[model samples]
Target: MTAETAPLLELRDVGKDYGSVIALDGISTTVRAGEVTCVLGDNGAGKSTLIKILAGVHRADRGQLLLDGRPADFGSPREALDAGIATVYQDLAMIPLMAIWRNFFLGAEPTRGRGPFRRFDAARAKDVTRRELAAMGIDIRDPDQPVGTLSGGERQSVAIARAVHFGARVLILDEPTSALGVKQAGVVLRYVAQARDRGVGVVLITHNPHHAHPVGDRFLVLNRGRSLGSFPKADVSRDELTRLMAGGAELDQLAHELERPAT
Candidate 1:
């Protein structure tokens, strides 16, 4: 691949096992900068396992993880974070009672003073939070507002903007829109596109093909811990993706079996 289109993160035949159970097997995909790579799969499709591996919450039993064309093995979540890989899970890891700026810089808060005089730079944190959110096209009237006051979609967008602000090159979103309404989900997808426009490689994990197809440059479909196949947007239609995610031939057979006998 050319330097412009080279993968920021890549998985080569990656597999993971939990005792006798194989959670993932021979899964391969790539996440290029300024592009969204959607991982579409139904329940029990090993999506969680894959996320854990990518986020360093769990290690792969086999295969390779490449970061910026170099082999990488993240031993823990901190390691992955330090490597510029950030994950925004559904829960978002935010404190509802906390202010927006506080949540934005939770663990990595900015400090202004030194030695015994050291203290959190609340003003700088709030200012930077405001600017970052505005840069991402997220309009928050007040950075002092509690995170609990924002809508589900807004919460998701904040998480995305926070990742971008923290210099995350590879952002992994786990089921970002699964619990949202259609309009709300669209809001999250818009930010996903915005992040792509900003040259971030995004891994969007979702079960919805409709949500995945629109903004995704590539799609990786998984079923029962195995890949159905990986296809570029040019190679796969939304209908086909939906079918694959719904069990493809298995779904067709169920429809056939459920059909009436010439009634």
Candidate 2:
């Protein structure tokens, strides 16, 4: 990874609004290869809005979206995929009854043969899925197992592997650990690191500072549709991050209000 190169994806002064409601305002950040950029904020902090724009679900109203140092405007999620940007939402879009290997390939299946005789290569799919997951430190007992049979963390890892396998240069994870327990969230965070090590620019969107602190290379804090600013890991601490996310004034006031009830 070139430490000084331009970001793989960047949003410059990007923003979105719906009539009178400003969903996101003056947001800017860079996602560089081989690093995790955590977008942290509480509910209603424009996190979802930011994810939508990055995933190409909505166009930015006020700024430029750059890819590889050139301006890029993705018309749809498919266009974003073609541009090597892949998004993994919390729901995961997986079929519970489908085998893990099948879910891994989902819409883009490996195929072989000519014209009408072409068929999905199940063997290659299973083998590649197992190999990739194992490389990410995930050990699956069997590829034929149903996706629903896997734990939350394992499922997230599979989605990530699929993205990386299909040529995604940048990965956007939307609240990957929101519904997970501590142990499971840790598992997902490890894969986030794995993706970084494998040279994928990762955008981790979540409200939990603890989860972000351990794996993030940089932090971008958002609040009520505005960006506080971007901070590198070395520039900020977990407690400071948590306070910013919760609103420093609000936290301080709450702390004082709850202080011993001073009888």
Candidate 3:
């Protein structure tokens, strides 16, 4: 495919195993710039395994991982970050007592001065943090405030903004809205769209089809380490996606089993 049409990241028949336990099997998907691809599955459905593989924490044994249509084998998470794939886990690695700007530039703090005289450029860090958060539609009146003071959704948004600022080509978000309330969850989804609009391909991993359907361009459903299917939004309605995610026949069985007997 041409450069413009090529997916930012592609996985072909990818599979992984822990001894004899297959965690993923023949899984295939693609993440394109300016779009969100949601991976939906219940716990034990291999979602964590998938994230580990994509984040370079583990290598897929049976498939090809292509970046810009070229095969890639990442040796470590650092390698994945260097290659423009950034994964934001549920527990954001921010220091609760640290200032927002300090957390923003955490490990990669900008330095000023020379040799022994060099020190963290606090002014530049604060300015950039404010600008970047504003760009993401996050208004923080005081970036000097402790990050722990921010709400969960705000924390998630800050993580996303940080990824975007650091040049993440493919953003993998692991259940960002899982612990959030209805309103807070909405806040995080908004930033997910913002990232996509900025031409960063986003892979949103979640079990909630409700959250995934609204912002997703495509969906890949997994169950027990296997793919139910990959579908475009046009091909799958929100209700249909919900049904598939809820385990179709199994859900039906559950409902029937829970029904009260007629008097």
Model 3, residue 15: C-alpha shift (Å)? 1.3
In angstroms, the error of model 2 at 193 is: 0.8
Model 3 global lDDT (CA atoms, 0 to 1): 0.93
Per-model TM-score versus the true fold: 0.96, 0.95, 0.95
lDDT of 3 by residue, 1-263 (tens): 22378898999999999999999999999999998999999989999999999999999999999999999999899999999999888876578899999999987789999989999999999999999999999979799999999988899899999999999999999999999999999999999999999999999999998999999998999999999999988899988887887789989999999999989
Candidate 2 — worst ten consecutive residues by lDDT sum?
1-10
Off by over 4 Å in 3: 1-4
Tally clashing residue pairs in candidate 3.
Answer: 0
Error of 3 at 215 (Å): 0.5
Backbone clashes under 3 angstroms, per model: 0, 0, 0
List per-candidate RMSD values in Å. 1.4, 1.4, 1.8
Model 1 clash pairs are none
Cα lDDT of model 2 by residue, 1-263, tens digit: 46579899888999999899998999998999999999999999999889888888998899999999999998899899889999998985578899999999988889999799999999999999999888888879999999899888888888888888888999999999999999999888988888898899999999999999999988999999999999989999999999999999999999999899757
- Whole-structure CA lDDT of model 2: 0.91
